[model samples]
Target chain A: MRLKMDFMGLSLKNPVMVAAGPWSRNPETIMRSLDAGASAVVTETIAMEVRQNVRPWIYSKNEGYQNVRLYSDHALEQWLIFIRQIKKEGGTVIASIMAHSPSEMAYIAKSVYKAGADAIELGLSIPHGEGVAVMGSDPDHMYNSVKRVIQSVDIPVMVKFSPHVTNISELAKVVEKAGASGISAIDTVRSIIGVDLETSKPLLATYGGYSGVPIKPIGLATVASIAQSVKIPVCGIGGISNWSDGLEYMMLGASTIQIGSAIMTLGSEVISDVIEGMDKWLEQKRLRAEGIVGKALSNLKSFDEIEILPYKAVLKDACPESSCETCVVGCLVGALEKKNGNIVYHQELCNGCGLCVSLCKDQNFELKWRL
Target chain B: MNIRDVAQRAGVSVATVSRVLNHPDQVTPKTRERILEIMKAMDYTPNWFARGLNLNRTGVIALLIPNIMNPIYTEIAKGVEEVAHNKGYYTLLCNSEDSKEKEAAYIEMLLHRKVDGLIFIAGHLDPDLMTRIEETRLPAVMIGKIEGNWQFSAVYTDYFEGARKATAHLIENGYSGIAHITGNLRFIESAEKLNGYREALKNADIQINPKWIIGGEETIEGGYLAAKRLVRNPNPPEAIFIANDWMAFGAIDAIKTEGFRIPEDIAVVGFDNNRMSGLVEPKLTTVNLPVYKMGLTASRLLFDEMDTLSSTSESDEKADQKQQIFLPLTIKVRNSCGHQDRIKAIFGE
Candidate 1:
């Protein structure tokens, strides 16, 4: 199974790194996560000054959790001290730097590297930074910011990019061109979780970064594009809750996986199970953690590049005398006809897209496989 | 020149001038134009303080519902509007369409419009909503919503008791095996109804067959398919207790299509005494829900809180605590659950 992995030039015991968030804010918290089986840990996005947070800074609903905590509240000196302590304890710590400008970011990067952090992760994806206005998505700002950190620090510099952009792949390429050692695909998208009809205001009222199980599809898509577009490794992070999610990220070419929200919800204990499950799965499939990286990338192709297959919907069960007529109506190709409930599959019309199969999977009009 | 001078110049009443200025829809186009022209000619300006004094009350309450198309929701809408009208308040009805995104957008727009209060017909209070309610300091009432043990200011019908009555009635009619059709058990109301069905069977000392309890979609088609499945089974139930009226209609149609005679072969009882209850061939026997009353009472609660909300000196954190309101339910027995004596009398004659 061999769970040992490497991110950039730094060798990691495993691929799982805790993303820079509230969980990784303090030295004590980061150390606790390391002890909980995280191969590497990222310090929460730290800036030059400590910012005071307001009451009720987080909102959650059926979709996801909206976080308004933009950056670390700890002073830069405090973070440098924490990094030194964590490094002395042999923790694979990655200091996260967020500053007002490239010069400030370069200064923080130099300080953290001097403090003996294994690496540094740039907070270039914050929707809104407390001290520094987030201009991370701007190509000029991202390039200048990453270039400063890269020139200042000898350690691997990973840039986490926000998904709130028109072309994330282009953004990833810009950071990579700036000499970023790796890319962390997806910072939370600015989202309004829900609204309080009672108050006539947005749930949080302010646009907040959203992350959870619901944001995985978009996050994975970002990871795939960045992995395919750039030469540097991609650290897939966003909506990763467990082992399966971690595996999915690696399969999509994430050399290292970062977890944030799942650890917050499931607690530090889930770290062990995730690593263990990944270990067991890799062994059961006779695969290595590094080998699985980009295994699914070959399958990630453009729409025009895909090869269409020919097949028709087949009926397995006895048809009803009178149907709800769901599959017949759902078929975009008009390949299905239901008289009463008697199904007549138009074999020639089927393209094997299997839209009807999904629609009728658990319904009265349970369509069979594409044959 | 002021608004008074404009009214004098236009040969119209001051009220007409005010109406054209504030409430233009109430003024005819001809009168509105004349007043505007007179004001322009006189260079008349309404006193800023006087305008504030005129439209003192915002008097707008946002009523957010899951779907306006749902008959039950429409009834609740009528109820909210009726009560709001009595209070000299206008209800801004917004259909969230059961989506959290749409709900959030409407809530923001309504809040920006300075709604005096809000009423949500939500089954679950999103934690985000809870925070927004706290931050805005607006009096809000929830209608027919409950999540876990946390009770909100909700007006929900006693679905369990109503369902128990329906099931008990079928038991009383000498129907041994009774099947209950319901929406997904994820919903609090649906689960409550199911529990009532189970309890009724338990009280009657009859074994509850798991297979007979069909979990169907909350639609007419779902009910039809589920009813067909139940009837085609080897040991079919003699009577059915459908959770809602719309689905009950479908079930009745399915039963008829299956060549079953009402009461003689099978008996059916539905919930929600909707308009279509009496329109069908054999009228539906159902649980009469206080739809209008639920909405009316919930709105009344919001109105009462609106008083305290307006006078913030009296309200504190405790004022935001949710209050749960449970309304009573009654059975509306019709021809669908055909009385044996009545059926016999009709056929015998």
Candidate 2:
């Protein structure tokens, strides 16, 4: 069966999209991705005209990468133009906007919806130089920003979060509480590609947005955490270059996957290839893409939910009637002790955090699921 | 008991009581101990609002940068923060996104908050905003680029020289028909880089090809697109010098996709020497812009200005202004520019 995933109330033909960035800056790129088989295209973050050009270094060069600071001045007009073009081309467009203040974001969201965007993607996590240090990292700031935008716009609202924060689940809950309709798990993680040792300055704009296969694991971890934490549908993004990557996102609880840097490197043809490959994989697995959404999520457990076994009991169990007391000395948690000529467990004081699991040579000790 | 009651009990004025509480050493120890004992006896607490009103300083500094996505600004921010923290100052970092209006707003906000000083990473500073900054007489310093007759102190890398040296190195290596891929020329640094590119070509007696010079977005994708166009030409340049490392990576990717080997088919050099440059298969040879040092210098300048103003008598209206500081740049020889083997051979064990 063909996959049909739903985010909030919006329906998708499949769980594939083009995440916000340069990929969705204009109508032409949006149309290209749709033609290449993307279900939806999330627009770039629209900041206030004042916030658009915060620094010149924003225009600085990196290794070989360059991003034009094109989304400046008359952003509303540009958005309208792009939205109209996308609509004319029969593509679904999600207007992504970032604001200095909540009211401003809401105003932009309303205008974007009026301009014919299917949804408004509130970019709560854009790791711009000063923006990340100020607004991007704070949960309170993100919540208030989402709340203001949600109250201002009538259309469905989704917040794109940064994976750079410490707790994705907490941030997801904050956005949900603020009335966001859905969550797009992960904006680009803040990273410095490195400085030129010769010039002793940074390689790109001084600081470059890092994405690629290197960040896939972090994106997956954040998406999985957010999906399990909140009831809202999660749209996973970051380093999804192929169908397998897209499928992994779905299994990790993403209702949809967003393509960005991959398309930049591989071209729009990647969207079609990913979709075909995903469809083929689904058939082989006897499951639809939609079916995989939240599949692994049920099995996902929080760190606190893991039940760590008693170390002494585990060690003794592994070496039954043997005088190998190596595990007691190797134990860092002090949970293991020799009692009554045998290793004994003190479960009462054990926090069950599982720091002793790795120290043991035998696979006897395992975290049991607490009922 | 309130501060007023403590002042009355200690037989001292409210200002004296405040001075004792905030600047204990400024007051006599006998008087300070008397006030402290009275305050302790009465369990009196001083109001922060009133204290702020008297001090007229927030002990905060506003740091403005172009983009957070760029690690250079962030590293500069890290340096600024390090010195700011040492000086007991909190930094309010704002990303202007290279917009004059946003920078203006952030300046106003910081001023409204009564920040002690402002550290600005230069971009497009509107004339009106520059006028306002000058009129406000706020201690401000520019980092990364210097603009408009140096109204404020600035710490920047010598972009013109850095770019010139990089291009000269490439030219000396016998790379003819070198193409240049740079960011938007509207920026001062980009202009400097373009100038260096042209100067190197002129010095080498090689005719400049306008078609070879591609100005696109400063991104890997932009580099990829530019590389695609450059390489497809009937006679592409023997070597290409990209303005930034990010574009260089994209250009390399584009060249590889076209089944061309780096250095062998077409030598490439990028600026910024970003982290991924050395890690990449061929590695990247590029100019280094000392972001952290620039940030530290800018921040230190601001603090030094603030200190001078604070220490100067209120009657002395005229205060000495700090001058701009320009940091030097050096090129890192890496594999991407075909210097890997040469360097290794020279430094053989």
What is candidate 1's CA lDDT for residue A276?
88
What's the distance in Å from true for residue B184, model 1? Answer: 74
lDDT of 1 by residue, A219-308 (tens): 898899899889999999989888999999999989988888888788988788889889999999888999999899998878999756
- For A168-231, candidate 2 gives per-residue lDDT tens digits of 6788888889898988867766666666899987655534456766678888998898888899
> Can you write out model 1's per-residue Cα lDDT over B27-61, one digit (the tens) per residue?
54557678878887778776755654555447678
Error of 1 at A10 (Å): 1.4
Considering only N, C-alpha and C atoms within 3 Å, which residue pairs clash in candidate 1?
none
Question: Per-residue lDDT of B164-207 in model 2, one digit per residue for the tens?
Answer: 88888778777877899988787788888999989888888889
Model 1's chain A TM-score stands at: 0.88
